[model samples]
Target: MPNHVAVNPRDHKDLRILEERSEGMGDATMCCITFPEEFRNLQNHYTILFQLDQEREAFNCLAMFGLENGENLFLDNGRWDASYVPLAMDIQPFMIGRPSDHDADRKVVIDSDSPRIGKGEGRRIFDDNGIPTAYLESISNKLSHLDGGYRASSEYIDCLKKYDLLEPLSIDVTMKDGAKNRLVGFHVIHEERLNKLSAEGLAELQSKGYLMPSYMALASLSNLSKLIARKEAAAINV
Candidate 1:
């Protein structure tokens, strides 16, 4: 099944209209990550996750507000038996962010079991430099009392704030009870100045079918990046 069909065949013109009328953010591309068990058959951009969920789909969605085709897709699949959607790009920079031995002290705990976390085994830790990372058993004894996953470390969040990039934006989960939950997970730390794009930047982005973007989406990725970097640094230094 196709992901999105224009209500009007002439809506193809709307793509140009959308390109020109896109506000807030200059031009955003769709970042769709699918879980093999869910969206193994679907492959289309601009589809709604909830609708996809209703259609028995399983995929994560992100509006990559500012990106060029050649950029890396940095992501971590913390769960087992999970397949990450490939961005059809080079794998040089794409890595599974994990924890480290130095973080043998850091832990991730959840309060409720009703949510039924699947990948509750260990933590992926990053090194100080934020490049290479490792994984270890979560050490926090207090985590059994919290709901959802534990909030990422403050160190991770602060660094993400510094880079000023877009985040995973949203999470769409279809529970066992057939209910879909859209958790606005990450904070949108920055919003684009749509009315303020420089003529040159806009022209360049437009010509290349890319936009440098004014706003950035943020999530726990910064911490994951931090943990990876920290672990790599620790390993190298050791």
Candidate 2:
């Protein structure tokens, strides 16, 4: 479990966070939450998919990095091989928090127990004068983007649902060694339905600024082949 606390200069002035990408730093996940706003960038390198959040009874967007658990094909030689890392993955050890459900103000919270927490060997969160550092400022921007994106994503999903534009996706992959892998329990934009939508429907989606993201999600499927190639190469090296 994460021990998250509101960040304050008094108690967290010495805090430093490692920014390297590695399995040891909790970057081994196969996917991370993403939003439609990021679809344009994510589609270039990741397969964007929608996953059901059973607890919340809602669907959340995801940027797929690998086919299996604990496998992140984008992590190469201690560096991420993508131009745009999803804000959710980039804002590690930091999150937006509110004092109450109705609170309008948000606070930056840190996961004190995260592996990224460093012993004065990484990016300092604050300077000697108790001011946030440039690294921390960047993180704050990422957190804000993620926080706002999360809320906006819910509305996007609702719009998709209203138009019945989502469908289940099941992918099966065969490795060079004849090993089989199956990706299940995820959804994707229904391209056929989207193509068949009426003009009014299209206009509505366009007016709401969802038309392009819908196409972006569909286009991201092209990266699945790239993902499989990476998996095959990794297997050969191992």
Candidate 3:
């Protein structure tokens, strides 16, 4: 469990965050939650898909990084190979929080238990004057965007559901070494249904700026082949 506390410059003056990409910092994952706002950039490097969120009882978008559990092909050594890291992945050990449900204002919160939390050899969150540093400012921006994107995701999912645009996706990969892997329990945009959508529906989606993201999700499937290629290369090196 995460020990989250509201960020305060006075209390966390000496706090710093290690920004390196590695499994120890929790980067070893198959996928990360993504948002439509980032689909354009993510489509270029990741296979964007949707999965059923039983808790939310709705679909959640994802940016796939590997074929199986605890495998992030994008994390090469200490670097992330992708050009655009999902906000969910980039904003580590920090999150947006509300004081209470009645309170509409949001504030920054930090995970005190995260491996990234450190006092030495990392980026400082606050400077000598107890003011937020440039890195902290960037993190705040990412958190804000992530918060907004999370809220907007519901509306996007509703639109796709209304249009009956989601379809189950199952991928089977056979590596050169005769090992097999299967990716299941995910969904993708039904291109056929999207193509058959009524003109009124199309206009409505366009007006709400949901059409491009729908297309972006469809385009992202192209990267699945690239991901598989990377997996094969990793196997060869191993």
Candidate 4:
């Protein structure tokens, strides 16, 4: 858990956050919550897939980092291998929070306990005049975009569910060193069913911008080969 507090220029005018993308600074995770808006960039380097969150009873886009659990293959020598990093990953210790007292109030909250947050030698969140810096404004905009993207992503997932276009996926692979990896429990877009949809159904998806994200996800399947090659390279170097 992170210790979060509302960010205010009056009290935290000198807040500085570490901007370096380094391991142990919070990028060690094997997967991250992604969205349809991110599918295009994600397809270039990472496998884009939808995962069901049983607790929330909704689907979220996930960008996979490794074949199995806890192994982040994209972390090469403490550096991320991809040219495009997801916004969810870029948001870092700052997150959008809605106050319970106010129904529609959205505010920026920072994890004061995060190692990234420090007093010296980092990106300043506010200027000496207590105005938000360009970097801070960018983070605020990204978080706001993410908030809206998630709502649309949920509706898109519901559409796929309504048409029964999502199917369970399982993949079994044999690594070069005779290690077996069996990945299961993730849901994938049903390409066969997708192709056989009615004209009206196709039009609905196309009009809503859902069609492109679906194809982007299917295209990401080719990245499995890239994942395997990276795994092989890691194994060889070991």
Candidate 5:
């Protein structure tokens, strides 16, 4: 299903260009809908409609489809507007749910054939296989209240340094969004000691986008911070 083209029957009639009815609104218009690479993995086709006002106001209408069997699938309305990064944060339900005292052994599995997570839900489930074969109604019900966002602060870095798990890396910042003053920095790990880094060490790196494992693999050897310091010292003739 590389490219799909659909015709709108309502707008198929040809009107004379000289007529007043055709003067304001053009008769034939074609819309090319392109999907970003990230969304290619989505199994089902989705349609989104967006409306914007003069004051930069925006609203969205999600298309809800009703199948002959009375099943429903809500298509994302933002598909035509901006690219989105799909995010899935691991959940621990005990903390968020009351009591926070569920035994570690208690766990639940959601299968695609399960009625609660019907066939056409919003959050689809993919087997370790190449294709997504299941759908889940909600991740919230299965979630345990384990708060999991742990960013590596400077103190955490100090601890990692004590274990020799962290070393100084290069910094390269990209300024792409001037309006937001957003800066993306890269901290490259040296190839010699990278294999020694463990899952816990990688978790610390995950706190900063720049420290992603792929960046470690492709980062330059030269340390930008050290180079700046050396340049300053030489300028002062120290």
Candidate 6:
């Protein structure tokens, strides 16, 4: 559970959030939510794939790390050993909330229970004059980007579905202990099908700037081997 309240300068003028990156910051996720806007950065480190949100029946992109839940092989010495961390992971403890009434407004709320919410060598949310600090402004911008990203991602997901490019995927991992791990219920873009699209169809997608990320996601599949190596290394230490 989260204790989220509306942010106000009067009550939270001295709010100093810990700005550190660690598994404790809720970055120890096997898969982090991502959008098409981050494909280039995300592809460099993790495999990008789409998974079905069974409740909403919508397709969403994800940056995969390990084969099982709570198994993020990207963690090294309690630190995220990656050149790039997804925006979704970078902005933690703070989240955008929507109103339930007819008025559609988003509120900025922080998870009170988060370890990041203590006074320390972190970011100061407000200044002496009660104005937002530079760090706080950046967080505000990120929240706005997230809202836009969700809108753009909805369009991107539709684009992939309209062309039937998404294909179901099941990854089988052979662990060092001779145990088998099967990752199922995920989907990836079918490269063959994408390549086989008609000239007109390809032109439409290329015009929309959707083709590049599709290919990038396909390219990222190779990093799964890197994940396997990571898993192996961790197992050796144990």
Residues forming the 10-long window of minimal summed lDDT in candidate 6:
19-28
TM-score of 3: 0.97
Report the lDDT tens digits of candidate 3 across residue range 10-75: 899999899889999989999998899999989999999999989979899999999999999998
lDDT of 3: 0.92
Tens digit of per-residue lDDT, candidate 4, span 1-238: 8888888999779989876666677776668888888898899998877788999988888988888777778776656778987888788889888788767779999888887886687888899999999989999999998878876788889889989999988999899789999878788899999999999999999998999999999999888889888888989988
Clashing pairs in 5: 92-144, 92-145, 92-146, 93-143, 93-144, 93-145, 94-144, 94-145, 95-145, 96-145
Worst 10 residues of 5 by lDDT: 15-24
The candidate with the higher lDDT, 1 or 6, is 6
Q: Considering lDDT, where higher is better, how would the candidates rank from best to worst?
A: 3, 2, 4, 6, 1, 5
The RMSD of every model to the true structure, in order and in angstroms, is: 23.4, 1.1, 1.1, 1.7, 21.2, 1.8
Between candidates 5 and 6, name the one with more favorable TM-score. Answer: 6
When 2 and 5 are scored with lDDT, the better candidate is 2
TM-score of 4: 0.93
Per-model TM-score, in order, reads 0.19, 0.97, 0.97, 0.93, 0.23, 0.92
Report the C-alpha lDDT of model 5 over 135-178, residue by residue, as the tens digit.
Answer: 22133332322122111223433433444543333334332332
Which 10 consecutive positions of candidate 4 have the poorest summed lDDT? 19-28
Q: lDDT tens string, model 1, 1-238?
A: 2132211223221111111112121112223332212222222211212112325322223332112332222322221111332221111111222246755543332222211112422222333443223221121211221111112212223332344423335645443445444545333333353335567645654454323212112222333333334334434554
Segments in model 5 whose C-alpha atoms lie over 4 Å from true places: 1-99, 102-133, 137-165, 168-188, 195-238
Q: How many Å off is the CA of 19 in candidate 1?
A: 38
- Cα deviation at 230, candidate 4, in Å, is 1.9
Off by over 4 Å in 4: none
What would the TM-score be for candidate 5 when compared with the true structure?
Answer: 0.23
Residue pairs clashing, model 3: none
Q: State how far residue 151 of model 6 sits from its true place (Å).
A: 2.3
List candidate 6 segments past 4 Å from native. Answer: 101-105
